[model samples]
Structures are given as structure tokens and as C-alpha cells.
Target: MTIRYPNGQKFTPVPLRDKREQPRDHVTFSNRGMTLEEDINATNAYYLNCGMAVIHKKPVPVQIVRVDYPARSAAVIKEAYFRQASTTDYNGVYKGKYIDFEAKETKIASSFPLKNFHDHQINHMKQVESHGGIAFVIIRFSQTDELYFLPFQALYTFWCRMMNGGRKSITKDELTACSIFLPLGLSPRIPYLDAVESMYF
Candidate 1:
């Protein structure tokens, strides 16, 4: 099967992991090993435990068509399909303010590809912004081990330019000028809310 963007641009689903290989031990603690989803999940748990906020990853509902019961063991999923396009990776309340955002990671050292985002995601952010909620993206540059908090307004500006035949990636300088770098830590490894407080609040 093939997937295409709304603009008819061919979209190739990047290889996430080779099914025939097992991840090696002693792998560095980087975005290559841990995805944004995993980091946010752990952070959300920390937030809840510390009474900081209530946030959750929205599960993508799916229909399971086939399952293989191999020997008397666990069942393996054979076929499944997403029910619909996901709105956002996460949403919650922080300091009595509603928050909605998406998280993305890039291996590129210089820029984040615009292709990493979709039109639906822009629309979702617009909706959040319209509701007077905080909307933004947490972008991680794996090569540099740097994470930045980019507000939705900045993202929307870049997105608009992309639609007008601008560069497909946001340059490092642009990110530096428009985003707030989040400090790494032990608990809530990516302390983005700190940046939020300093910049937005």
C-alpha cells in the first residue's frame, strides 16, 4: 500500500525498526533508542506523581481483524487498522490552562523537516489555539541531543511559509531564534514546562 499527502506528494513511511533485528544492549540514551512517545509517557507519569498536572497520550483506536494463537502462548496480532487520523499526541491541563501539543524528533543536525508535520496536525493546533489553550511542539534533535519547545504560533508561521514554496526544513538559526531550549534532567527528563513558564506565562 502507498500513502500520499493531501497535496498528492508521495509519503514514504520511514522504516521504524527492522523486524528481523533485535536492538543491541548498551545503546546510548538517545532519541534513536527512545521515541518522543516514550519520553512523554514517562514525563506524564512524573507530572501526575508530583501533582504537577494531568496529561495523557491519546490512544489510536483500531480494529483487530486477525490474531494468531501460537501454541498456548500469547496471541500475535496479524491484522489491524487505525480507526481515524489522530488529532494530537497528547493533551492535558497545566496550571489551570488547557494544553495540547505534538512531539517530533529528527536525526538531522541542521534542521527539522517540514514533512515531519502534516496538514491535519496544523489544523489540530489551530483548533487548540482557537480554544485559548496552549498549543506547541516539542522537537528533539537527536544528533545534538538537544530538545526545544516551539510555540504553535511559530510553527504556524513556518507551516504557512512551507505552503508558499519555502524550505522544507526549519533551519537551526530559525529554531534558535523562535524556540526555547528545554534543559535535560533526571525526573521529567525533558523539562519543557519550565520553558513554557518562562516564555509563555
Candidate 2:
């Protein structure tokens, strides 16, 4: 069967990537080789299972353009596009306090590049803060497998400095001084709430 575009043109699939070219697992948090996002999702599941916290990843809004109805199955989506730019990655209620945060992974060990973040994300964080919600960023140094929770206040400071033509990134030293180090755990994988409880809650 040939897949055609909306305009009757053939839809050529992108070439498959080589297995060796795939992202290599760096951290042994679970000893099972999971990406940072997967680990965080597992952690959130663990939290929800035990009635600890209620954090969740925000869904990306996709506008579906076309769908194909199969013979005996549900319709399959053929085309879709994002409705708008994503704000934060995750948000929920933890102990009655509104929790909103973005998770990022970078390979740089000395400093985390601010280029990974967008202006809209910073603006959303500011909005969350103004509304008395807990806003922060969870950063993982993929090469070192080190994770840190940097609050919005600290992130804002670094962002402003970058805008002022200062350093374009936050150094590891600065993160160590201002951020909360999330210890790796066996069950949840990324036990970030421990640091949150210690610092904020």
C-alpha cells in the first residue's frame, strides 16, 4: 500500500536510524538503562501509586488534520501539528501546593546551556511564580548522570544574566550552590521529591 500526502504526492518515510547511532544510556539509576524522561515518568508513577504526589506531564496539544479508517480497527491519524508552543513539561499538586516544572537533559558537565530553554518557558515559570505556584527546572547532566532541581528564582537569575550579555549558561558550581541535588533511587529512579520535601515542603 502506498501512503500519499494530502495533495496526492507520495509520502516517503524517513530512513531508519542505525542502532549504534541511538542515544546511549549513561546513568545506572535503575540498572536497566532508561532515559531521563522515562526515569522521571517511572518516578511519577511510583509517586502516584503510593499516594505520595500527583505530578504529571502536560499533554502536547496536537491538531489532527486527517485520519484513515481501517477495515476493522480504529481510525489512524495521518497528519497533525502542534496547536501552540509547550509551556512547562510537568505540573500537578503536591501536598496542596501547585507544582510546575520543566525537565531538561544536557551532556555538558561544567555548565548547562541556556539555549536549551526558550523564552516562553521562562515566561510561564514567571507566571507560575506570580500565582503562588512552585515553579522550577529539573536538569540532568547525561554524561555524568547527575540530576539537580533548580528553582525558578535561580533559573530566572541565570536567564536575566544571559540576557544582559553575561555567561550564557549556569555553571556546575552555581548549580551546586543554589540547586537541590536529587539522589538516584532504585524504585522511583528519580526521587526528586525528597529534595523538594527537604527544601520547599
Candidate 3:
């Protein structure tokens, strides 16, 4: 299948590993070569099962353009295009508070580049906050296996600085001061809600 962005650019998805070939070591909080999305999905599943929260990933709207009828019972989609840009990765309600967040991972150890975020996403988060909703970001330093929950306000400060011709990235030291450090665990892989509770609730 071929998918394209709204701007007519080809969208190639990252190849995923087979689950059957992966190890089932759920005892440790190690990286285990899993992608950030996979970890968050697992955490969300656990949260749902435990009745802790109701969060889900936002699905990207796509317009199907072509389909191949390979068989009478199977019709394969051949081409599709995204209808619009996504606002955020995940959203839901927790403890009666609306939650919305974007998760990103980088291998850089010194700083997290602001280029990882888009202006529309920032604007969306701001609107979410203005409407009395909880908005934040989950940043993971892949090299050091360090994770941080950065609030929308803190992120807005750096974003504004960048727009004013300031530093284009947030340093590790700055994140340590402004963001909540999240330690990975077993039951709920990335325990981000704990940080959220400490900061917001």
C-alpha cells in the first residue's frame, strides 16, 4: 500500500519487528528495543485494564484513492492520502480532567531539538490548556534511557524563545529543572500519570 501526505509527499511507514520473535521479559524496565509508540500503547492498555484511565491514540484520517480487488473476498487498498495534519498523538480523560499529549524520542544525549515539534501541535496544546485541559509532552532520551514529562507551559517558554531567534533546543539541564523525570516500570511501562498527578492533580 502507498500512502501520501496532504502535500502530495509519499509517506513511508517504519518497518516493525515480528512479535513472535521478540522476547517476553516483562520483569524489567529496560529499553528492550521497543519504540516509544509501542511502550505508550502498552502502558495505555494496562491503564485501561486496571481502570486507571481512558486514553487512546488519535487515528489519522486518510482518504482512500485506489483499491485492488485481488479476490472476491479480499479487496486491498492500494493508495491513500492523509486528510489533514494530526493535532496530537494521544488524548483522553483521567480523574475527570481532559488529557492530551505528544510523545517523542531522540537519541541525542545533550539536548532535545525543538524541530521535533510542529507549530500546529504547539498551538493545539495551548488551546487545550486554555480550555482547562491537561496538556503535556513525553520526551525520551534513547541514548541514556531517560524519560521526562514536560508540561505545556514549560514547553511553550522554550518554543517562544526559539521563535524569537533563541536556542533551537532544550538542554538536558533545563529539562531536569522544568520537567518531571519519569522512571520506567513493569506493570505500566512508562509511569507518566504519576508525574502528571504530582504536577497537575
Candidate 4:
């Protein structure tokens, strides 16, 4: 099966290693082998299972253009196009507060590049905040296995700084000082709501 974007760009699955066959010890950290999207999706599943939250990844809608019938019972998609997504990555309700955020990971040890974000995402977050919703970012340093909860206000400030000739990214030192660290756990993996409690409550 093949998928493509609305603009005719081929869609590639987010790179993910086969967890069943891979050695668990291959990476030092619990999240070492997992991509940011995978971890967040898994964590959201955990949350849902535990009745902690109802967050979920928004499906990337696609427009199918071609299909082939290899067998009577099997229909394979040969070509497709992805449609534009209108919302952030994950969202749901937690204790009456609407939670919405995007998760990103970087290999850089010192700084997280602002280029990691897109204008549409920033606008989405701003909209979330404007409506009195909980808007934030969960960024992980994959090389260090450190995750931090960066509030939208701080993120917006950083964005402004970058636009005004400041550094194009946020340094680890800055994150350590300004963001709340999310301790890794075996179940939910990213305990970001803990950071939310500390900052908001």
C-alpha cells in the first residue's frame, strides 16, 4: 500500500523500529528506541486505559487516488494524497481543563532548534491559548533522554526572540532553568501533567 499527500507527495510512515524483535537493552533510556510520536501515542493509550485522560493523536487524513486488486479479498492502495490537518497533534480533557499540545524530540544535546516547529503549529497553539485552553509543548532531548514541559507563554516568548535576531533555538540550559522536567515512568512514559500541576496549580 502506498500513501501520498494532497499535493501528490508520497507519504512515508514515521520511522519506527520493530519493538518485538529489537533488544530492550539496545538503548540506555526507556525512550531511546521510541520516536517522540510513538511515545506520546503510547502514553496517551496508557492514560486512556488508566482513566487518567482521553488524549489521542489526530489522524492525518489522506486522499486516495489509486488502488489495485491483487486478490479478490484484498484491495491495495497504490497512490494517495494527504490532506491538510487543522489541529494540533494531541488533545483531550483532563479534570475539566482542555489539554492540547505537540510533542517533539531532538538529538541536539545543547539546544532544541526552533525550526522543529512550523508556522501553522504556532498559530494552532496560539488559538488554543486564546480560547482559555491549556496549551504547551513537550520536548525531549533524545540524546540525553530528558523531557521537559515548556509552557506556551515561554514558547511564544522564544518564538518572538528568534524573530527579533535572538538565538534560533532554546538551549538545554535555558530549558533546564525555565521548563519543568518530566520524569520518565514505565507506564505513561511522559509524566507531563505533573509539570502542569507545578506550573499551573
Query: Tens-digit lDDT track for model 4 on 1-201?
Result: 468889999976776666656554332222344577787888888888999888888876789899998876789999999775566778998778889997777766888888767788888999988998899999888887888999988998999899899998998888788888888887878887777777776
> What TM-score does structure 2 among the candidates reach?
0.80
Whose lDDT is higher: candidate 1's or candidate 2's?
2
Off by over 4 Å in 4: 1-34, 67-75, 82-86
Error of 3 at 17 (Å): 14
lDDT of 1 by residue, 16-129 (tens): 666337444322322344566687788889998999989888876688999999998999999999665457778999999998988888767888877777698889899889
From the highest lDDT down, the ranking of the candidates is: 3, 2, 1, 4
lDDT (C-alpha, whole model) for all candidates: 0.82, 0.83, 0.87, 0.81
Off by over 4 Å in 2: 1-34, 82-84
Specify the poorest-scoring 10-residue window by lDDT in model 4.
24-33
TM-score of each: 0.76, 0.80, 0.79, 0.76
Error of 1 at 54 (Å): 0.4
> For residues 115-178, what per-residue lDDT tens digits would candidate 2 score against the true structure?
7778998999999999999998888888888899999999999999999999988999998899
Question: How does candidate 1 fare on TM-score?
Answer: 0.76
Candidate 1's displacement at residue 95, Å, is 1.6
**In model 1, where do residues sit more than 4 Å from their true spots?**
1-33, 66-78
Model 3: clashing residue pairs?
Answer: none
Prediction 2 global C-alpha lDDT: 0.83
